[model samples]
Target: MKLTSKGRYAVMALVDLARFDNINPVSLRDISLRQGISLDYLEQIFSKLKKNEIVKSIRGTQGGYVLNKNPNDIKLTNIFNAVDEKVKTVQCRKESKKGCNGKATKCITHNLWDELETHINTFFENKSLKDLLNNNKETRV
Candidate 1:
């Protein structure tokens, strides 16, 4: 189960925003340059973010984006959900009767993969932008 660039880039961009947005709103162009992500892509990601109310857009010469809530209050899971990102380890849906191998029963590893997905999602649920920023500061020091 690999995460797509959409999920990873959204996290990276938000981390960058959390780092500098306290000074002023952060522009996607600036985040794009620093994160080496395309501006167009950031715009797309931010559109979803804005719609989800995770961020608010500003207007004018210094117009940009800012977090709608505190960094500590914004969990990674929230960002992933806002961007329609899913952490799926199994090919089949959990509620579906079908198996991952398209057989009568689930594959031997299906339970293992499902458990792993739960762990991964729980980790993200427990992590917030503040945790990431604090971890960065600790590593730098």
Candidate 2:
């Protein structure tokens, strides 16, 4: 259930957006520098996010990207889906027969792995990026 680099960077990009007080766009170059992501890579990710309505861009001297919705309105799953981040812990986690033995006895811990994966996927699916921000605030004060 590890997040792909795309997903990780996407979240970081959003967090950078969250930090800014103004709806004014933040340059990709600045986000890349602050978040330690590549400009080219951020551009590519932003294309997908923009298409999905997760973000909107403003042009001109103030040009850059901003969230289409408020921070609390965005979900982690929304960001994850924007990048095609799958929740499988292994190929077999999705019923792939590539490496699995047919019998349950052969894969002694198959059920456990499957259950764990289900729980993880469910958690991420239900949780939102907004929840993350709320929790952070709660802990601080």
Candidate 3:
């Protein structure tokens, strides 16, 4: 399964948020400049983030966005869901009863794909923004 730019960008943006959380209410413009993401794209992404309660917005010239929860409490899966990014390894929608073959019967490889999806979700669920920060620290050192 390949992670699309949406998922990657959401994670990157959140990582940026976590990095500057001490400063609180980080502006999208600042994140755009630092991360090289487009301001328009960030607005769309932040809209979803805010709706999911992953982020909170502040008003005023000094206002921007801030994490609603601790970085350690925010998992990759949460970010992914916030952006409507599904961890799909197969063409078929797992939520549907029909299979990839356009039949009601399950595909022979359905179980395989389903298991892989579970593993992927589990990996992301176990990882938090804090993990990303710690890993970055190790790499920099």
Q: Estimate each model's TM-score.
A: 0.88, 0.74, 0.90
Candidate 1, residue 26: Cα displacement in angstroms equals 1.3
Report, for every candidate in turn, its global Cα lDDT versus the true structure: 0.91, 0.78, 0.90
**Number of backbone-clashing residue pairs for each candidate, in the order shown:** 0, 1, 0
lDDT for residue 17 in candidate 1, whole number 0-100 = 93
Candidate 3 overall lDDT versus native: 0.90
Which portions of model 3 miss their true places by more than 4 Å?
A: 91-100
- Best-first order by lDDT: 1, 3, 2
TM-score-wise, the better of 2 and 3 is 3
Q: lDDT by residue for model 1 over 38-64, one digit each (tens)?
A: 999999999999998889999888989
| Best candidate, lDDT | 1
Model 2, 115: alpha-carbon shift in Å? 2.4
Query: How many angstroms is residue 61 displaced in model 1 relative to the true structure, after the best TM-score fit?
Result: 1.7
Better of 1 and 3 by TM-score: 3
